[model samples]
Target: MNVKQWMLVVCFLCSGTKYIPNTCRTFGSGVVQPFQGSGFYVRSNCPFTLTRLTHNRVECDVSIRRGKNGLLVQVEIIINKVRTVLQNGNILVEDQSVSLPYDHTYENIFQYGIYTRLRSSLLPLTVTWHTVPAGIDTLWVRTAIFIRKS
Candidate 1:
């Protein structure tokens, strides 16, 4: 098949394929791991400090190979062992599931990215991820924190 025809075929076949959780590789301080089940849990170490003077931006990149039917992904800022999912103006809806971009067909997989800004006033906050495992399996979930200090 020609280039255009080959591309069309690829897309047609990939639409039914599952997503893949790519490994994390970025500049920041966080962890990217996998978990199972529909329960909620923490994904970071407590007592973590952010940029000293300026604001910090945290990004959560997740890829799903086979998403669960009722999967829900939520994030929280943990402080002193307190679990809080709301930060600044971030919203956590009841059906907050990992949604891949519409044009995410390059690799025949689904990917979701989340960005959140952290103010200096929220220093010493522990950023954690809580999500239900994908329908297939959890591979890699990368979380990056960017700031002048880091």
Candidate 2:
């Protein structure tokens, strides 16, 4: 083969024509209870209500109302099969006074491989939150998820 032919072969091999799986599942939202006045609390048992529907996408939205004191909301997203952590951290919003509200939304791509891995697996993803100020008597949070279509 000539040099030109060899280059063409290499280019074809490196082309981005490979097919990628595009299947994902999503979970619904739920409420999270906050700690009592002037104290710390960890929400490890927070549950994500998942639902199977059209389109392969994942979406989550959380809202919170802090009382007189400020509060911190922590969220974590994980892909169980690959043992990967997509997102993990905390979002802190201060309550200037009573009824301080905050909202957050997240979306991710779920390919075929990821969808299959999570299909029969429990705890495919997890989210957690905690209150900051000890005096903050109220904490409220909600979450949701979506998966893409195959």
Candidate 3:
């Protein structure tokens, strides 16, 4: 098949494929390595701090490959124990599940709860992911945090 034909086929196959937990933007490339993860810990004074009912959005871009063994990827947010913030956001707390397809890129956003406790502040957060079936390697998992100023 020629380049244009191949592109059309891909579009047709990918069309109407609903990815769970939709976000505002998606970008990046490459397959994610199993067990490999990275995240950012924002200090309270960085730029913005979350307040009650406020929105904190996170964008995650991951790539995966179909190896000899299939696997499932799970991503979640980790809040520092010191902080008393409560997450009252979306219930679909995780990203959409994706299957390996000749090494393609996938991206999604997660909206989490803001600080609910009045006495607590300076919340530190991070993103984490793990693969099921235990042995498949993840290419890369990266996260970016955006919070509204209180």
Candidate 4:
């Protein structure tokens, strides 16, 4: 965690709102939830939502309200803050199967998942997003990360 992240984490905790310690950040209107990973993890600068479609399935959607100016939503799916995959135009998760959102979300997915199940437990991953205007264009991004282990 950097100084800014530490400050944000402190702010969230000081206000009586519970947030994952040392993790979670608020960039512009974007709210990113931090996860413990073994070098491969995901972090977003814009707003993203992980919706539960079923008991054991979920979907991740990222929306950049503006800066696109109705032109297009271009995104760079960065993994471990190293690898980069450029995704142009609108994000069409529907075009592909929900079983692997990352596959369609990014140009090329280098994660662990399949049509039946995701091999996430075997290799924890990390990601960070970079938009056109970056995090300097928006004021707030509403995001939520809900995980239920059963």
- The TM-score values for the models, in the order shown, are 0.20, 0.19, 0.17, 0.21
Ranking 2 against 4 by lDDT, winner:
4
Superposed on all Cα atoms, model 4 deviates from the true structure by an RMSD in Å of 15.9
**Model 2 clashing-pair count:** 17
Residues 6-107 of candidate 1 have per-residue lDDT tens digits of: 785566456654323222211112322333223333333232222122224422222211112322222333322223333122332222422332121111
* Candidate 3 local distance difference test against the native: 0.26
Sort order, lDDT high to low: 4, 1, 2, 3
Clashing residue pairs in all predictions, respectively, total 3, 17, 11, 13
Ranked by lDDT, the better of candidates 1 and 3 is 1
Candidate 3 structure quality by residue, lDDT tens digits, 1-150: 799857855664566432222112111122222222443322121112111121244222222223223332222222221111112122122233323211212222232232111111222222322223442222222222333223
**Tens-digit lDDT track for model 2 on 1-150?**
799857855664566333232222211122233322232333333333222222234333332322222232222233221222221122222311112122222222223321211121232232322322332222222222222333
Top-lDDT structure, candidate number: 4
TM-score of model 2 relative to the true fold? 0.19
Q: Which TM-score value belongs to model 1?
A: 0.20
> What lDDT does each candidate get?
0.28, 0.28, 0.26, 0.31
